[model samples]
Target: MAEKPGSQEAHLSSSDVSAGQLVQDWSVKEERRARRKIDTSVLPLLFLGLLVFQLDRMNLASALTGGFATDIQVTQDTINLGNQLMFLGIVILEIPFNMLLQKLGPRKWMSAQVFAFGLIATLQVFIRDRRGFLASRMFLGLAEAGYIPGAVYTLSTFYTRRELAKRVAILFFGMFGGNALSPILASGILKLDGERGIRGWQWLFLLEGLFTILVSITLLFLLPGSPDTPKPLLSPGLIRFSPAEQDILQKRLELEDNEKRGGAQGQPIPLKLVWKTLCHYRRWPHFVSTFAVFSTWSPLTTYTPSIIVALGFDRIAANALAAVGASVALIVVFGFAYLSDKTNRRGLSVITAHVCYLVTLIVARQVHPHVGKWSRFGLWTAVNSFAVGYHPVHNSWVQLNCRDPRERSISIAMWVMSAILGLMTGTQYFRGNDVPFYSTGLRTMIIMVSIGMVFAIIQVIVYTVHNRRVAEGKHTSSDGEEPMIYTI
Candidate 1:
């Protein structure tokens, strides 16, 4: 086989080329494997962060029922006002905070916010009057406002539209799960009612706040900043992308561009945007529906335990009943979100949830005070389950309709603001003198729920008609590729 020198040189060159190609192939495979592994690990951490965030927010409601209000000499109106103030702060700060998050990234900003809120919450034990509690609540609200929407926006960045509903549902389930567990935690903490000169409510703040702080610190190490960011935990084998995988990533970017260009271009969301969004004929119905429904139950978080206590149940039983509401909420949220995603119909799910709420509220209103404790518990649980289930679907509807990120952020903030406004005003409806029965408040809630139902129906009609126009290619300009349709 000893040929000419030129031929031998060419043969060696071809062999070297073949070896290089094989190495490249191996590298690509390794990268793919590493990406999958990293995704698996990071997803769980994201879920954990969401869970803890929600837990911290709702724990205060349960804690307050453990005598925090009396110790601070505050009324139910004052407690709700504190919640209202917190939400007001959230309304004021959400956009700026979200923008800061976009600049600083979630890993730094979200963790810092969580840590700050925990510190403030822990310090709340020293609050001696309405003003101090109010100040603390406002700070807490400001710190926490960006967490939920930021998480939602972050999730959207990772998952496709098709995969988002389930992921969002899972994240929210963690939140409700925390809400469910808080009462149980409160039950145990209440046992230390007067231990170490610290009140039960103080222990509630201290323990939960400490736990949150610890979780935030852990997250600083565990969380992945974004999809493109690399971590040391990922194996080298998975770091490289195959030709096909690279193509897929490129296509996704192209699609994102198309979407951004097609949507209704508005000025960067400002206070005026809120008014403009409100005035959009297509959007008002959904906004009103959401306002009515959320407003009706806004007091439930702060007042449910108190309501249960007034029903002649002990503090522990009241807390337990609140847990039942959380459990029921979990079931409804999962069920409704699944169906909504499967059907690709956010409006129907919201409407169905609202109808269920209406029925439950009516039933709750009619239930006899002379009825068995079990019956009363069942009634309240049924109402709460419907209410909780309705929340996610409502939010999903809003998110789905919002094509512009800036507009979406503003819309969510406004929705939350409206809800808080209702809570602030609604608290006065449930005076302490109306305890045990709360006839006026219950009746008002029933009317509000009914009004919500009407608005939900109207939104469904509007969304359906607009979607039909989109399908027919008759309404493509205003709503991007589709007509702007809003659903509650």
Candidate 2:
């Protein structure tokens, strides 16, 4: 018997619906697998690169007491001048480096930076005087400039805004891990003093610099520009991606980009983009907050070893003890980043972290040397961990607010420049007279972090208001794109 016309129509519609659902299910499954592949393959390589970057950048701190100043014949003042010049180099070169990364892509540009900075770092072993030392530091800074921002911008291309914060934390965990591990590594290498008639500090530079160069060669062969193109320079077929996976990743990002910015995702940045990014008054709160928080690293990171040594420990012991704070930082940074991503509450997480930092700084400043050294050490660890915890949240905030890719690239560069400028002021914080306690520097850090908290508050308020406006359709997007409604 023939089926009725109504029954036939109903059967055809149900079959179409089932077919669509099956396709959707398959796409979702493929995306999950692809993301897992990315997590394992891509993130670890990026983490390694960041680890190399931080090790090279922060080795100078470990070298301070290992006869660096004595061999170079520089006073604390001269060392401070060198630090200032280094940051000045970073400040001057960061934007250009970021623009170059945009032009050349991450693989070639980032690899070249690592190699150049590695060579500069290795050259440090030849510095015979304060002038030579200063020049090497400046050259190192110039070579390392834009690395963090460039890495961040590159990662943003692969991950969604939500997936970014935790990945950023994992990447920065390399820095914290380097801070924790480099002390041990440097101290062990310092034991190689007088081997081949080279000073321990000289060996430190030579070995660490060589490690950076080796890593750069690996990166040159591993990292391709985007997820779509997995072809590394030499690896040819190393990172194979199925067409289905590519379609899912690309389509997902396009959908997200459309929702966030009316599909203004991959447009070339205008020449006036920097001027426009700089003038966005709403972004200033984040900039101020980033600068204030990052500025603390000058006295905090650069001087931690010095402070420990001044507290009656020898250089090796001081370096070992400094690792404790870095250990704490690694824990807090990962934990805080996990929470930030889970809650989608960037501003609250940052403000809370800094508030904890403010308390720890106060306690560290109040610890009396005559009483006990352990209290001072504990408080310093707390301060370091809390301070480091604020970074991933702050970075994600800036990137999310500037949804456009080109805008994000330029804005990240500007943010990094602001951080470099803030850090340049760091050299002045620890003067020759500051010595053991550096009480004034500690107090200055407290005040600066407090100011940063204020900026964090302002950032939350502005972003909240802006989100509300977008929700209510009161104000359109500033860039003539769709207004994105997101939580801070």
Candidate 3:
């Protein structure tokens, strides 16, 4: 029988196609039960890995206020260069490493990479020159390259698209926690200046690096595999799910994909998948927006403590105080993610978060120099509070626009690479040359942030137009197959 024009049944292969109705078909109660199990089993451990990832990399900034530069005989400019090279390393290897992760499975690959980076992170303690510092940064970046995308890919296999944003937001709390905690920890640890003849920064690296190594071991035992491969690397059915639960976990995702793919499912060859995913122009704004917005973070994160100190706080006080805003950001980002999931409005959520951040920045830039020290501190906190709240929401949005698992992997890798590239460019924003000119740094941040916001709006328009085409049946496969629907 021929399908009628503009009928949802034209695309819905299943009797129920909307996510809400599909949830009913999958059994709302059972989906909830399985998700609860997966949540407790999966998210916490991923958060641990992310926590350490943030700590391992961000410890450098904390080390700066602790005389790390003097010990290594390097200047702030050289440190910036090393930071730039570190992100360059991640960008170069992100895609290839993520592919390896998919091939080998996250169990063996992610576990091994965590251990590898932990070793590199600890080895930074021995660096006494510019060369060694540079070498450590590069090696650490290489080791950490694919972990984010790998985790996201793994999470995708576990959860439905609608559930992804909140989970991702939860996962990223690990990073935010690290950002908030690292400085506070450093303030106390840096006071151990000559403990056993080790400088404070060395102690910081050694203790934190060893802690990450232990976390790697813990994750090996605890991190759950896919629904079918339900055991962690070293576990013997420890985090195991029942057969019925596993069925729910895997089948729900497959069903959701069917609903989205409609009747136009064409499995592209590997090379073709790569090409098509790369050319999916609707996804470009996600990448560009990530690049621009994420660029604004490196300078702020790398210098926030120093900025605080410049506001008349002592180094130790600055380190502890720098954590305040990041702590608040956890609330902000989660609120955005939760509301986005509840409303099923990814674009509006992301733009709202981005605009909030930009408003804070613009207000800060205009009022900053005129303010008193405490007022200056408040503005800086506001700017940091909104920093990167859109990140996880943006990630979920990108994942939604992808057509297949292979495309998803590639798209996520591209998004993460864009973020790393942004960080790389931002390392130069507050280099030694711009050190004294606070306004110069603020201006650079405002420009990058505005560019990102523009791209984010562009992404909304792209999604809107594509969704309209799908509704009208104008969006078609090259072979004139039915159009696939995208979640806007």
Among these predictions, the greatest TM-score belongs to: 3
lDDT of each: 0.67, 0.77, 0.83
Clashing pairs in 3: none
RMSD of each predicted structure: 8.7, 5.5, 5.4
Ranked by lDDT, the better of candidates 1 and 3 is 3
Give the distance in Å from residue 134's predicted Cα in candidate 1 to where it truly belongs.
1.6
Residue-by-residue lDDT tens digits, candidate 3, 384-470: 899979999999999887766777888999999999999999988886766543688888888888899899888888878888987
The residue pairs found clashing in candidate 2 are: none
TM-scores of the models, in the order given: 0.81, 0.91, 0.91
What range of 10 consecutive residues in model 1 has the weakest lDDT sum? 8-17
Error of 2 at 450 (Å): 0.4
For every model shown, the clashing-pair count is 7, 0, 0
lDDT of 1 at 268: 44
Which residues of candidate 3, in runs, are more than 4 Å off? 1-27, 259-269, 479-481
